[model samples]
Target chain A: MNAITARLSSFRRHLDPAVITAFACILLLLFLGSLYSRNFLSPEYLLQQLKVASFLGIIATGMMLVILLGQIDLSLPWVVTVGAMMSSAAAGFGHTGAMLAIPFGIFCGVLIGLVNGFGVAYLRIPSMIITLATNAVAQGLMVVYTGGFSPQDSASPTMRYLATGFIIPSIPNSVLCWIIVGAAAVFLMNRTGFGRSIYGIGNRERAAYLSGINTRRIVLTVFGISGGLAAFGGVLLAGYASKAAQSMGDAYLLPAIAAVVLGGTSILGGRGSYLGTVAGVLLITLLQSILSVMQMPEFGRQIIYGLVIIMMLLLYGRESLSR
Target chain B: MKQWRFWFVEHRGTLMALVIFVVMFLIYASNHPAGFGANMVQTASNKGVLLAFVAMAQSLVVITSGIDLSVGMVFTLTNCLASWLVVGSPAQVILGIIAVLAVGAVCGAINGCVVIYGRLQPIVATIATGAIYYGIALALRPFPGGTVNETIADALTGKLFNFIPASLVAMIAIVFVVWVPFSRSVAGRAAYAVGSSETAAYMSGVPIKRAKFFAYTLSGLLAGTGGLFLTFFTYTGEAAYASGNAYTLFSIASVVLGGVSLMGGKGSAIGAIFGALAFRTIGDLLFVFDFDPLWQPLFQGVVLLLAVSLSAFGLLRVRNRLDWFT
Candidate 1:
């Protein structure tokens, strides 16, 4: 009995209140949304929202890892753009390019991520400034590459299949991709030594280093992962839209960040779970769906989105501080 | 030799920024079709002061080891408000100016409260508030069609006595009125203390909260000044989303270039103002050189990267590896 009780208590201790609250909010939002629109609660409508959210989930997963390290990656905007643009540009090059499109797009993201990581880890610049600079550089590069014209290529069949097609009828390929990524993230955080080190470093970098962790390598690796994931998300977006447009990735940066923070992850790092981020992604997606259903203007949706983030920060941010 | 080296070490960032700005400006002027005449200088100053004011605002919060991403939005919001308010009779214009400035201060105060009392991270808090402010601005001027008092606009944006730029005079006056007094005050010192080490400042009985509040509020006021100037230059209010975000990002670049530490408790607004000027000069340099306008972002990013990397040299000099984290 004592052993069983102990196991139960441990499980309860592991449960994050923020994630629970977020789940509750999701349920409430769904209920409210259904009342507003009869179609909102249907399985088909819900599945579609989940698919849309999968892209953000993928990006936010990378963002979460960086945020867990007490760093940020603002370059996601341009990185996503680069991923989409490059993949499309490559697709126009024929069979080899089409075959290599996805990898090449992801590679673009990883390269930029490498630059971002190098600056933050080796050069000792703040990630915010460095990433912002990289974003500008990426923007400039893309503009020059495109010669201020619309990108000339469409999404390849492989990308279109990955982004828009499904192996199972009703279950999205993108959601399956998210599940794979999400599962890996969970396994990384809960099971792997690297995940433990991420928490340790986030909690206290000096201590983590003194304890003999390769802090710099971990930072670079996470940044690379983040860059790659953001790019992957961008490629999916291009596939969904049929082609990449100029500044196509600008819309995701804030929403990705908002989703991460909403998941009850401490912005200061070292604490948070993928489950929380998952819930955050769902909540934001649902809120967005409802807003769109209500026909709210873009600016109004922006205001509400900003307010929700602030409200969440005030509530959960204080709890973390008190603890 | 040691004293001279110490002084040089302390002022190196600012001096470097100054030299870069001078060289770039000189190159721009020499290459310009209009030459370095009063008209040319006035035009440059008019364009430069908007960012200079915003950068100064950013410097205040940055000095407190906090960042105000909302400065750009506040600038835009105030610009929109000024277009609606800064018109008609002199008395009405004066009232309008005060109201606009007050709104900015209030915005800063809201940020301060959320960050300090609410114990939220400054970056996230400011981003939220920035979005809100931008939303308000967008709502205020959905299509960007509102006018400021033309007389006030011309007087501020135009030159003084056909030689010196009136905008330059206004910039200097604002520095005297705002930056000089704030930097000299006890609260300002407390702000620096808090930034350098908050626990140490608190233990030492520094009014950390008040200092931070003042810093953030003043930051808002400076941004408000920028917004007013933006109105003066454009003669209309626009709530351009891209422009606001660009300003926020560039202000950070300027702050870094100006020798202010992002970690806080170091550098000066004067440095940041020059940083802003230098950054603007870099943009104009491209124009004068006839480089493709598309190349500007790339060049700016490279310059920013190089400037930021300059400060990293000190990290290499530290004897203990642990010092790197600090």
Candidate 2:
């Protein structure tokens, strides 16, 4: 009993402003959704929300890792779009092509991530500026290549199964995939040497380097991982939607960053948890769901989203000061 | 010769950007001599003047180790406000201009307060405020339609002196005004000091909060001025007008390309002005080449990357040479 209490105390102590606010947001959203629409409480609606949240959650997981490394990857939306496009195009080539497409998509993501890592880590440029530039490059290339159209195709049985098919007749395969990725990410972040090294480098690069850690390698690998995960999410999204559009990635940019920041991960790097990020993903999706159900205009929804993010940051900043 | 070399070294980044601009123009002129003449010059100059002001606004905050992601949004807000408020009379139009500047300043002050007093990160705070400002702009002009007086627009857009473009003259005048305070005042020096080392500056008795507040307020004022110029150029107001993605990229790119460090400290108003011109010239050159609009963002990305990389290389060289001399 005493041990359990102590464990709980430790967990409570670790609770950051992002986590608290995300929780409050989640509860508030659930409450508001229920009040506004009875359908929101139904299992079907909740499951749908979870399914959508899973897509963002998976990408946010990678975003959290990159942020944890004291860097950012703004090219995520385009990377995701590329992944979706590749997968859709591959599906058009038949089953063999579909099988090949998953790896190919992941490869594209890894390549871009590597370029970003190289520019930021080796070149020692600011990540924000570098990633912003790269994102533009990727998005521009996508626009030129796609000409502002969605690829018309459907995934193969395997891809479709991962996207729309169910694991337990009610739970979505996408949700399952999210759970597996989330669990693996949590374990990798908490119990792995690589994770410790990431935190170390994020906290103090010189100290980490002196301690014999290959800081550059760690940074590169984290970005690579982030890219791969984002690609996987895109593949899943394509399977679910049955088509991929040019600007599909634009919507993910803010949410991916929002999840990481709302999960209590410091944007400056090195201090956050994957579990918290997962919660944040759920919270944001819920908030959006509630707002949509309330029949708010698109602009109004965006305004509220921005305001909530600001409020969360303000609350977090105040808490940090008091501490 | 020594003085010339010293000037070149001090202004190398601006010089490089200018060279690039000239080379691009020459290439364009060679290909399409007819279109690249006075008409193109007028359009490009007008565009450059507007962006120069926006870039200057961004640089003011950036020099203090902060960024104003809301500048584009603030421009949109003021543009819409100008259209709505300037309809009554010429006096009202003047009042509208003052009101726009005041609103911009207040918006910037809010950012300053949140960042300094609330101790929030500048990027995150501005991003949030950007959303709010954009929302307000959208609410003001929901479907993108407003008008300015035709006479006022023509006068503002037309040449002032016989040979000189009014827009160019206005840009030059604004540059001079900004330069006086930034290059010749203690407050301006304090901005550099705070950006270079905030903690050290604070310890040395610089009122860090005041400096930060003033930087943001100046940034807002510049953004408002940019909006006013946009009205003169376009003669119409739309909520979504001038809120292009290119605005954000070009604003940052112009400053960085002109030798202003992203890490803060060590920049000039002249450099930012040149950077804006270079950016506008690049766009004109691309359009002359008949490059697809879809590729614009990609080109911008490459240009920004190259510019920043070149600037970083320059800084590195300076450091190495200093080390060698020491």
- Alpha-carbon deviation at A277 in model 1, angstroms: 0.9
DockQ of each: 0.62, 0.46
Supply candidate 2's per-residue lDDT for A317.
Answer: 38
Question: Model 1 chain B — which ten-residue stretch has the worst lDDT?
Answer: B302-311
Q: What is the TM-score of each candidate against the true structure?
A: 0.97, 0.92
State each model's CA lDDT, in order: 0.90, 0.77
Candidate 1 structure, TM-score to reference: 0.97
Top lDDT: which candidate number? 1
Instruction: Report the lDDT of model 2 for residue A299.
Output: 70
Model 2's CAPRI class is acceptable
The true-versus-predicted C-alpha distance at residue B175 of model 2, in Å, is 2.1
Candidate 1: the clashing residue pairs are: none
